[model samples]
Target: MNITINRAAIESIILEVPDVAAAEAFYTAAFGLGDKLRFRASEEPTTGFRGFILSLVVSQPSTVDSLVGTAVEGGATILKPAKKSFWGYGGVVQAPDGAIWKIATSSKKETGPATRAIDDFVVLLGVDDVKATKQFYVDHGLTVAKSFGSKYVEFDTPASSIKLALYGRRAAAKDAGVSAEGSGSHRIVLGGSAGAFTDPDGFAWEPHLASQ
Candidate 1:
């Protein structure tokens, strides 16, 4: 495992699903994220939550509904409906391939008509020990952007790059409206410039060669 880069940023997320074609179709129609998300074929037995969530940060509540709506139309299971919350307006949905996604926006009001513009793509890793995993990522050359004790931490990543964050395992599960009882592989490989390595939580990463 190579972990020798400076200020590593996620270049892409490769989801290992049972059917790459179907997953590609679903994600394309749902998020329209393009090459930021990749897919491969795998039969790894992953049940319950996958210990991670692909968080889509949009500009407004309307956009949140737009993305969540398309996802549900594409066969996604809604865990949380879009609504206003203390943090903002958002919702949670599980993709057809069993990947949990949270679409949200800090803005409670509509700025304008809904557009397919995503402000940020954040990959939240649910770890047993947030502080320990935060240190592990720091050692792997990812700088800390925000830290709220051990409960939450967001890494500083390059602009237009996928961001990374950490949250308590059970807390993450609760946010996704699921139980923290997942087992087997995460079935998601994060690609970045940091070289190939597996985090303490068993999240695998590879050298990002291309978008596809």
Candidate 2:
């Protein structure tokens, strides 16, 4: 089922890292997740999971392996090996700047050769309360596409745009293979249509002018 999604879509994410040049080099060599991502420089001290995860959903198992391989080669620490799960096949990696990323695909079998193509990009925010956060976003113009009680929530988005979702803090940490404890800045900024305000989980979103 589809909901009445807002026309104002999420543009890109600005990640604050200690070294912008290094991060850019790593990402460029890794997945090339597309232009939906942006970066900045900040030495802000952030520990643990940083309350979020960036996921790259691909076409097939070969694509998943391809992306994950380059990510590891680019100084990323593998949190989980690429393997098949009940839901699908995927793996997790932590960037040098302490960001967690999950490369995954719903297809277990590879139909063709591997390529650097991203079918979807997801930003999973770890919130304190899933249901309340879901309502907060809904109140701020986001429409829910999927809600699994208090466990998870996925917001509807336009094609080729950034996708957003919410998950419990502890669960998100566990999924990233990290401790569920962190303090200080999340080291992230979201440029989107939800207006200039921080969400219930301290995730900030700013109104963005659509790039020409």
Clashes of each: 0, 0
Question: Which of the numbered candidates is closest to the native, going by highest lDDT?
Answer: 1
Q: State the lDDT at 181 in candidate 1.
A: 94
Tell me the lDDT of candidate 2: 0.85
lDDT, candidate 2, 4-111, per-residue tens:
357435778888898888998999899785456778789887776799999999989988888889989999999998999987899999988888999998888886
- Tell me each candidate's RMSD, in Å, in order: 2.6, 3.0
Q: CA lDDT, every prediction?
A: 0.91, 0.85
* Candidate 1: Cα lDDT at 154: 96
TM-score of 1: 0.96
What's the TM-score of every candidate structure?
0.96, 0.93
Q: By summed lDDT, which 10 consecutive residues of candidate 1 come out lowest?
A: 1-10
lDDT of 1 by residue, 1-212 (tens): 22334447898899999999999999999999888899989998988888999999999998999899999999999999999999889999999899999999998998988698999999999999999999999998889989999899999887778999999999999999999998998999998887889999999998887735
